[model samples]
Target chain A: MSAIAIGLTGVTKSYGDKVVVDRLSFTVASGECFGLLGPNGVGKSTIARMVLGMASADAGNITVLGEPVPGRARLARMRIGVVPQFDNLDLEFTVRENLLVFGRYFGMSAHQIEAVTPSLLEFARLENKTNARVAELSGGMKRRLTIARALINDPQLLVMDEPTTGLDPHARHLIWERLRSLLARGKTILLTTHFMEEAERLCDRLCVLEQGRKIAEGRPHTLIDEQIGCQVIEIYGGNPHELGALIRPYAQRIDVSGETLFCYAPDPERVRGQLRGHTGLRFLQRPPNLEDVFLRLTGREMKD
Target chain B: MWGRYAAALPANAWNWIAVWRRNYLAWRKVALASVLGNAAEPMSSLFGLGLGLGAMLGRVDGTSYIAFLAAGMVATSAMISATFETIHAAFARMHHQRTWEAVLCTQLTLGDILLGEVAWAASKAFLAGAAITIVAAILGYAAWPSILYALPAIALTGLTFASLAMVVAALSPSYDYFVFYQTLVLTPMLFLSGAVFPVTQLPDAFQQVGRFLPLAHSIDLIRPAMLGRPAGSVGLHIGVICMYAVLPFFLSAALFRRRLMR
Candidate 1:
């Protein structure tokens, strides 16, 4: 088997005058969890669709599970599982029937589907809601069922687009656990998400996209350490340049977003000592993480 | 154009059956209600318009008025049943329920989903069309074994109407938009297609318009079959109905490819 699970080379797509994915390229190694992190409409979902062969890219090439996309995409898709952004479970079917119908789409036999249904249900932690209609399932249960349905064919590559979006904290944790289990079992996952915590937790490596272009790509922690340093000091509601000048001797980088000014440095104490006399400034110091790298790379502008 | 059509074809011919089965499983829950709903409208027209109106008018076209109307009812019922299934029910699956989007995520292509939907709609229309034919046969309004020939014509009519309605389904922005198709297209087509009256009775220009209507082609085949007479120009009638079935399918596929896949 090829080490590369998904490979995109200079892939570009345009809708009329607007470019959605522009000369973007990446590859996911087999059994690795790779995340595509970007704000809304940055072509994350479009890349996911192109990888699945649901949409054709205008330029360059894509291969999934060693099969060229939009050409042998059907064959490639037979081994690919997808957890779409929204819960699109069939409201007409019970929990079991949803899996049954989805399995049939992959040409799985009745016996094969019957054998797998119970285990998938168990994997999704929905053993008790076996025959319940999709509408009857709670939001979390519906999301779990959607994941379980995706696994019926035991696909080689699992593509999840914003899998945890709109999920409550508890539900989000449960999904993260299931995903971790899949990774433990050597499943290659290609995920697209806006949740920095999700990417930091689940992804082995990730890329940051802005305006349909790759800004940075590496391990989550490595990118954070390299891009924003070890510490982030947030000084809220003050003149950014005036406060930034206070820490200029200690801080490596200074950035302003909205009402807060961020001071990044390797040593927190040196930066904090500079603000010791600034009691009324309402500043706090913390370790830098993925969000700092994200906001720094992609900016804090709101994207609809 | 030919290349695009080839690309639009299902990857595997039989893969569409899964989509058909999905719909069948869903419809099974409301099977009785769905079947009754399809049959009730046509049966009422048979009773109210065919019998009541037939009594006053007596005989036309050298046969009883109700008998001539029975054939029209079969064709009209099939058309209406298929149209509603595609425009309203299939639209719900496509736009509101997002079932088609989910299906696309699988190995199935848009062509497979559409083929399944069109087949299912045609099947539903068959049931409604068959119910009228059987009732007419039982009531001595239609010829015995010869009326059986109308069954295939009815099914074909379903395919024609279902395929045509898919164009409307693909283009409609919401359920509200269906009213335009129903009012401006379908209801007008019902009267213009010579389903209830002979096209010969209309002005020559109006009669020319009827020749292009899909239902008119369907009636040309079905009415003769129901009346136990050999149909005239069977090749032309079948050719026109087949054209209606095929042409709009590609149109819908093109429209949906832009709207959904893009």
Candidate 2:
């Protein structure tokens, strides 16, 4: 096993009476891409803040890069890079100046920052827009620049919080491709995201969070297979109660979500055969995925 | 956790230079506009009150009215520059621009950010105060050599107001929250602190209250230096301004830690 890069032991945090992060524990190994998946207000961002020492854990302990957190946080921060959820780029500065100033914040000298500017700009595909103000950059471009700024220090571990939350598919894909290259070069990453597809594509191991507690955690494929099975059959637009009664014996588990019934089973053919003669009912049989596992673990209720 | 945070404070003093440098780099693009804005108000006040009002009331304190008003302008301008920097500009960076959040993500701690903000405000105040002093010297209201004696007091005035204003910044939730400080505290301080008129001329009770105000002590030190007269109660005045500068600095830091750290 690789050495641990991040470890939390029963960490708990609260604001006033509301417990934001309950007794949660997880670890990310070196060179691993770990994802923290959750809905809004589920303590995903709170965990990220605790790791970065922005918010202190009210109970238990946290360690980053083998150093105790909130104590050795400044030292750990030297080797850790962060891409926050919002756009905190300096709006008064040009794109190049943004990178340069961030580099300065990490105690990098002018010569060092200047040496890496061209390549970092090229890496973000923003060579031509170096002089553009932050307000002028498109959302996609700004997100890319934020990622590039995080790399200015050449950190050993990168923590990205909802990196592609508001970007277009093309923009998200571009970011994912860049992250893949970083991981290929042996950089450990801790990612928090709501997009299951992004987690399935990028994360090596991920944990699902619900109301500050860990609901499920494993390799994406392993969790999906263990919790959801091999395939899902979605049957819609029919007498749902009658169809569920007929499909129950053929499937391992069934979930009803308002005019739709999701049937989970190992073999799609067997389930499909049971509904062969059921006309006027639409059904889609496909392989189960991380979304199914996530819904199963965190439930289908909408969270505020 | 609080003990650990307090321990991190002393070792991080020089780290705030990065935040100060960052602000300087951003300000470089519009340096001329900012310097002019800082200097404009004090200059107009000096000329307007010194020449316009001086012509009516001649030599109230054994010197030309312009000469007497010149020293008060130095103290008041420094106070205003530092106050505005810490209150409006610092609050904007903390809440709206999120610049402090970006810097805190680095190795720099919250203490470093607070010190850097106070230092930067003092630097801007010093520049404005020094410029007004030079203008006063050219206008024949101040002796060139005596102005040098007042530089330390001017810097102390900057730090005092900056640190005091940071307490307001830490407590403020929105831009509109600043109006209370400006109206209730700053405007009253400007009038009662002997910046526009002498505290001795006020009624007996108000005169006693002015003795405790930071601005009154600042003007006490600066006014004599500008007129080339012997300074009175120098140790008491410096002691009061230092108390204002140092105590509020720690208070503001504690408040910021509470506000920023959840």
Tens digit of per-residue lDDT, candidate 1, span B111-189: 8898889999999999899999999999998987888889999999999999999999889888888889889987877
Candidate 1's DockQ: 0.57
What candidate 1 gets wrong by more than 4 Å, as runs, is A237-241, A280-283, A299-304, B1-7
TM-score of model 2 relative to the true fold? 0.95
Q: Which parts of model 2 have CA positions greater than 4 angstroms off? A: A239-242, A276-280, A301-304, B7-10
Q: Which digits, one per residue and each the tens of the lDDT, describe model 1 over residues A80-160?
A: 899999888998799989999999998889899999999999999999999998899888898899999988889888999
Candidate 1's TM-score: 0.96
lDDT at A132, model 1: 91
Model 1 lDDT at residue B240: 94
Model 2 clash pairs? Answer: none
lDDT of each: 0.88, 0.87
What lDDT, from 0 to 1, does candidate 1 have? Answer: 0.88
Per-candidate chain B TM: 0.96, 0.96
